[model samples]
Target: MAFTGIPFAALDFYEDLEADNSKVWWNAHKDVYDRSVKAPMAALAAVLEPEFGQAKLFRPYRDVRFSKDKTPYKAHQGAFVARGPSLGYYVQIDPAGLFVAGGFYGATTEGIARFREAVDTEVRGTELEGIVAAMQEAGFDIGGDQLKTKPRGYEADHPRIDLLRHKTLTVSRHFGSPPWLETPDAAVQVRDAWRNMAPLVEWAEQVLQ
Candidate 1:
């Protein structure tokens, strides 16, 4: 797939990243960053629009101290598709996903607990369940290792034991897609994941709009 038509402006984020890493390879090849990331993402986004609506490009940033091979920049690009709800997915251009993460988190303990509660209570039976089940089936865990903690007012054996157990799917860009499916499996996986998240998206849209 080619990003033959994706405007260069949509991927202007790379130039900033290059400026930030002026002493590294990123500054030297600012022009190719899109070819490596934004372009692939554009290709995927084009194919996903019919099923997922318009996908927006997310800027790439360099995590200067993130790893041993930290090159002062990320080689892949990402974006969220918001047809009915907001959902995120990324495309890797480099040998990455050495570190990849996604999930819902609150700025404080109370907010986190409330988010967990909302998932278990109000949103349990809706699309969220499908998201959780699909993620689990895909071999990713949500909420990280914090799932073991109990809410401040909850008991150890509360029915919401598994109730408050909201989780997110984590996929390494390195892993080859599982069997079945045509096209890049990442988009398909994300679509199935989004299916269960439409309701929540709709709710948020109502509040924001």
Candidate 2:
């Protein structure tokens, strides 16, 4: 199917789900979920696969067995394209709006060690610094999990200590309820963000994956 746009009703569905995350609510409105939320998301992912590779739409059901919150359904609908072991591109439609992101998420311990080593090396480290700097300059928010303290061998004042402490890395941006999100231009916006993130994703794939 050709990519179109996320309907405004999709966002409304998620907002209502937040208030009533029970089987009764889901059963009553499943057609709306299928039509407004899942179909549009699948269409969007289908169009993105040519350049970014196949995308996986996350299932809405939440795994509550190990969690305390126990919400039955996810509050958002997200899609991911796994470019490498722990590296990927992602998009989502939520109550707030569309979110686009890409990078390494939950890379293995050994991979994180290699990431730190690469950051500790001046030649390679400066390349990453430049990538992050440019993304920030372009208004993307750089984020990831980090250690509270140093990564053992690195000095407290290392040039890229901040980058060195990352256990997982990602770059993301949110386009909050923009007019484009409710039209076919939504695909263009998502494509642009993913392309912008290619450098960072490629770097992590080489170093961490």
RMSD of 1: 7.3
lDDT against the true structure, per candidate, is: 0.47, 0.92
For all candidates, what are the clash counts? 4, 0
- Candidate 1, residue 187: Cα displacement in angstroms equals 4.9
Tens digits of per-residue lDDT for model 1 on 1-209? 73333333333444555346444656566566656455656776787678657767766566657567655555446565643222233333233221222333222454445455555554453445565565567665444334557655667776555545433223222333233222365555555555544444443333223
lDDT of 2 by residue, 1-209 (tens): 66679988999999999999999999999999999899999999988889999999999999999999988999999999998886899999889988999998887779988999999999889999999999999999999999998889889999899998899989999998988787899999999999999999998988875
Highest lDDT model number: 2
**TM-scores of the models, in the given order?**
0.54, 0.97
Model 1, which residues run further than 4 Å from truth?
A: 1-24, 63-71, 82-93, 97-114, 119-131, 143-148, 162-174, 177-209
What TM-score does prediction 2 earn?
0.97
**After superposition on all CA atoms, what RMSD does each candidate show versus the true structure?**
7.3, 0.9
